[model samples]
Target: MTLYLHLGAHKTATTLLQNVLKHNEAALEERGLARIKIQPRHLFWHLYRDGDRDAFKKRRRTLARKLQQYYKSWPNAVLSSETMFGTSDLHRVNCLYPRADTALRVLAQLTSGMNRKVIFYVRRQDNFIESSFINRLQTLATSLHLDHAQLLSDTTWCSFEHYLSSFTPSQLSWLHLIKRMEAHFGAENLIIRPFESIHRGNAAYAESFLAPMCATHDLELAPQVYENRSFSAKALEEFIRLAPKQGFANLRSLRLHLQDKYPNTSYPRPMLLSPEQRQEILQTLATENSILFEQYFSDVDRTDISYQPVGS
Candidate 1:
């Protein structure tokens, strides 16, 4: 069977895609696209890296059997998780484990004999950094005693800088993850696209994501789909502000309050890098992005990467 792994670099529409596939799982399976099931924190060794060393390996045997079952009956079997790309840990400064060696080794073991395809979505760095910060801040606002005022002081540039520093720009780029996966799956099996392009034509990202893979295999995806986009910044800010004033017990009530207030308007986005800063960063990335485009999208005249495709 062909194995399709939809990895997320966080802040992408990974959850929405999962929710849609979940909605149409049975029909898609009948059409030869069975999504491999994964436990929330287990598949990618998230809990294992968090110190519960016992959580990941045990599940691999069952997953391997599922992979075999797909090999026997299905034309195309799929797996998807944002955590697989070391994304869920973005909120924390220095996580227990930033590397994904254990997860990768386990995956390599489980999908041993299958033709593996890796698909990932890319978002612009500035927007990605902002979205990631807001999501993390919201998670903290609802759960922990965080310094929301200080975080809100001026802009989130410093916070974003701190996060980018942890991984460094080179590591933050998907080219890094793509190279790592290519080591295991090879460049021919990799399919990378921009998060924005996937959502083009007024289609939901989830709706557009699976259809193409099906077409490549001469199969079709289920027509029906679902979407669960992330929350807006206004709602997040309200959550932080009201969580303390109304107490954590009343956090839900406060959330309803903000949802009613803004309806659809997102809060103002954080300070993006200035033109000079952006130009400098792009200069640094020029060669690397060229190499990435050369390796992955050589035939296409353009690439999803922001640092202009080679020979713009």
Candidate 2:
């Protein structure tokens, strides 16, 4: 069996892709592909061999056995999980797919194993940072009382510097990550995509990139998938305003609690900065995220892609 794994680096249209796949599951199945649905739809740990401790490991060995059973039942499976990209626990992953390689090494390992393919889409640093901040604020508002200014000021809240504390600039840079993964996996086995190209109303970009893998597995492409959600900057500001008053201490707890309260909340709009604020935030990000930004921009220029239109 061949596995097509999409490891999201976050805030890069993962939800869009998942929605597309889920919406077109029937078409995908006709093409000899399966979405591998586990109950609770959003949860992916059910597919891994290790029981999810965060969810109480309810099924434990039974879940793992079921996953293995399904895995063996199909010749081609596409498994996706954004959380997989954030985790540093190699043991948890190894336990699931014993022969699977790390995201940084999966490309080369695919040649010997069940023909593996890794697909990753990355957003430019500036846009990614801005959007990520709003995401954090909306995420924080559920539990804590937070406003835009406070969230921006709190180093522990959301900032390029804070993220760098956990992941090195090199490790976090998509260009570097791709290079390292390609070095181990073989360039042919890895696919790198820019966020701009995929979002440019070109629904075929995803299918084009996945075509080779699909052909290898005798799978067909589904019809074009459209985005149902619209981007909103105003909504983000409102979320930020509601944050601090919510009284949650950290983002993690705040997110869970917020989901419980507003289960249907969509992506908050991008926060719009005034001219002065935009310049100030840009300068701050540039200074605080110098190493990472430089690396990230260098890759952007080399790739010759922009997530937004000129002047946007």
Candidate 3:
């Protein structure tokens, strides 16, 4: 049985993909694809359960026995979990400090002796960094009653370039990431593609994700409306400016009020990379991006990679 693993790099619409898979489980099964709903937390629990070594040992054996049985019966199974990529966004930023070899190695070990393929969707660096920050700010502000002003004040919370500085060299770019992943899972078995560029001719993004093992391409069983939408610049900025004063009750009430308040209002701020920022980021990653286009995606269309620089 082929094991298809969708190891997500977060903020790349992973939730939408997982939801589509869950909603269309029977359809996928009919097409000879089974979604493996094993909780990744179980693997993580055993990996880090240090307090009781004896207990951990017993738990590991039991889990392994169960997985072996599951693996036997499983047919073209697919597992999707963004956490498997080792991305962490504590306060709306990827403060993901991964011990590169260790984390991915654990994943490699779990799928050993099986025919496994990994599907990873990558985003433009600047766009990813900006979207990550915005998503983090919104999530933390609503859930933790965090003050935007204070959160911004923390020197650690800076631009995406600054964010990259904190990451290990291997975690800095998708090129490096793909390199590590290829090392662990072999280059031929890894399917790396631009998250933005791979939707050609597909009715929905989820269909593209399931393309590797699909016997049939009927996606009529799934919903195409993207539920988790991005906050417009105006809405995102206003939410940050106002989050400072909100208590638990106010946070929820104020957010609802804002939604009602600006039903059709245009944003005061731009949510994505400014043209200048995008140009600079491209320049910064030019070499790596070229390598990415050349290596893994050589046979595919290069339209997205051909984005024009700032001044024509």
> TM-score for all predictions?
0.74, 0.57, 0.76
Give all candidate RMSDs, comma-separated: 5.0, 8.9, 4.8
The CA-based lDDT of model 2 is what?
0.49
Candidate 3 residue-wise lDDT, 1-312, digit = tens: 888778777777788778778877888887777887666554444444334667756655665565456568767888788765433342333323244456567667777898889888777776676766655654554422345556656655434455444433223467877888899999989988777753453244666677777854556524654354445666665766776666645655666556555432343434455677667767776777778878877355475455325553
Q: Which runs in model 3 stand beyond 4 Å of their true positions?
A: 40-67, 88-100, 141-171, 198-204, 221-225, 248-269, 303-312
Choose 1 or 2, whichever is better by lDDT. Answer: 1
Q: Write the per-residue lDDT of candidate 1 for residues 142-254, one digit (tens) a residue.
A: 42324444554535523556655554444445566677777877778778766665535324455457765564233223234433334455665555555555444554455
Best candidate (score: TM-score): 3
lDDT order of candidates, top first: 3, 1, 2
Misplaced by over 4 Å in model 1 are 88-97, 141-167, 202-208, 216-228, 231-233, 243-276, 298-305, 308-312
What's model 2's lDDT at 129? 49
TM accuracy, model 1: 0.74
lDDT of 1: 0.59
Cα lDDT of model 2 by residue, 69-176, tens digit: 545776666766655433222111212122223433422332344566677666655565455554545544332223535654565653334442433222223444
